[model samples]
Target: MAGVSLYSSPSFSVLCLAQKQKLHFSVSGDNQNVPFLSRSLASLRLNSSANPLPVCKPFVTRFSDSGSSVAESEPDSSVIKSELQSETLVSEPVKQEPKREELFAVVMVGSRQYIVFPGRFIYTQRLKGANVKDKIILNKVLLVGSKTSTWIGKPVVTNAAVHAVVEDQLLDDKVIVFKYKKKKHYRRKIGHRQPITRLRILSIAGYEDYPAVALSDIEPIK
Candidate 1:
């Protein structure tokens, strides 16, 4: 009674002892339940493969929509204004003036005429068959200060005086003229000398009558 007690059911005692140990065991059964879990995971994987995730696209900022984007993209207004001003400031071409016409004149002497500008005159030899100086008056003027011959037509300038003296009146040797008719004993001869005079156009009057002919028109006959 003081030492030990013996049990009649040994198996029950062993069971009790096992209970007291609190034994735990990992499941080692066949993979019969695993197929359902595997199938569920496979289904999940198939679904993920079939419906892939959407990819993100890059964002595009339009100038019209955003004020900051517009300001940064556009050119400066001050530079544009300066370019316009430069174009407007261009200079125009200059026009040149026309030239003036120079004045001049012409003079007439006897039947022949001569061109005479300011400060110039001409003295030509008199005609061969002209009459004696004292008998013939050289007052008749053909033209005066006009380009055309019709200026001094029939109206002679009354004071248009001219005096001429015989320069070389010595009788020249008579030149003989002979005409023969094919040895028909017919011949003819004639001889004569010519007279000449040196005319000094004294003073041209009535030149001042026309405003075109001034005191300056009377150039010394040089």
Candidate 2:
């Protein structure tokens, strides 16, 4: 029939299995010895065998490569213990370097001004009869700054004094001055060096509102 299918025949599976690899298919049957039917039958019989594959085996997986590498590269237990000990060091806050106070004082000495700091020296115009290591009080504080506060004076603060010790008495380098009058043919040459004193600031004291240190309940022997 025109609507007939080859797969509907009884030998479909057998022929498929036989020719699965080659992908070739054909069929024939006797129908009153027709020439076309005879040729089809001969072709079908010529390529009837199949080459289908057999059933597959079960699946399996293993990680021996990764496991073997890890095993081979492991450190000794003692090394591991030491590393663990190092990592377990006591945790503490980061200790930063101590910050210096930004304290300074502006004091006047011999008609000159200076900004002095604790334990630092400043040069001033020569002080009469001042000797090295002689203690002196600077009573002309114009301004004073502490770590957290500043005090200013209208002209000069009262009672604020800086204690200092004379460190040196020295002269500045000589400076030369030349005066000339070309038409009058007159010339004057002069050289001068000024005297200066080096004083090391010891401390600044005044109404700083510092915490009062408690006096001993009993006075100590002088």
Candidate 3:
């Protein structure tokens, strides 16, 4: 503002002269000089198109290898079916047969308890009124057991009996009882043999009279 001067530029002189002459611009309807502004816009569009901005290329994903991997991992239907058939074939030979039943019982005969098995002879206290080869039926069964189950009675199993044949009547070894007194000079000796009966078990029956199976009919474990 200190060193500035007026009437220095040509544009300032033209503005002063136009103002003095009272000159002005007026736009009419339908007919106008709008192409001058349109030409400037068109020139701007041409400049933008002639020198375009840099374009970036997008990265692409290839699925060909992934598809191949999926195919390789998938199991074949035919191979799965063949494997099941092979398992069935291998299992067939290992199957086994049903096992036979085993049965026995604990019977009270006279004053002693005896574990009786079919076809086996067991010695018991001397039985009265029983002769050789005579089949004797005992009803004092305490417990009856089988391969799968067992039944125990409160005192004795009712209706369950053991049938045995008398094989022999014998006496046991002698047991000596000696009495002695030192300084008294008194001595005595006594010997005795207990009577016993050897009986062969025939069968054992349950409440329903189902006969017991012997060991000879039972099959051995594989």
Best by TM-score: 2
Across residues 40-106, which tens digit of lDDT does each residue of candidate 3 receive? 6657888889988655432222366667788899989999899999988887565687654477789
* TM-score computed on alpha carbons, candidate 2: 0.50
RMSD of 2: 16.8
Candidate numbers, best TM-score first, in rank order: 2, 3, 1
lDDT tens digits, residue span 1-222, model 2: 643666667688677777864544222224444656665665576655454454343222235666777888997899999888887785566899986667788998877889999888888999998898999998999888776566776676667899999999999899999999999989999999999888999988883653222344336889
lDDT of 3 at 111: 74
Which residue runs does candidate 1 get wrong by more than 4 Å?
1-137, 146-151, 163-176, 210-222
Q: Each prediction's Cα lDDT score?
A: 0.50, 0.77, 0.78
Identify the leading candidate in terms of lDDT: 3
Where does model 3 exceed 4 Å of error? 1-101, 208-222
- Model 3 backbone overlap count: 0
Candidate 2 achieves a global lDDT of: 0.77
Worst 10 residues of 2 by lDDT: 209-218
Model 1 is weakest, by summed lDDT over 10 consecutive residues, at 23-32
What is the Cα root-mean-square deviation between model 3 and the actual structure?
A: 20.4
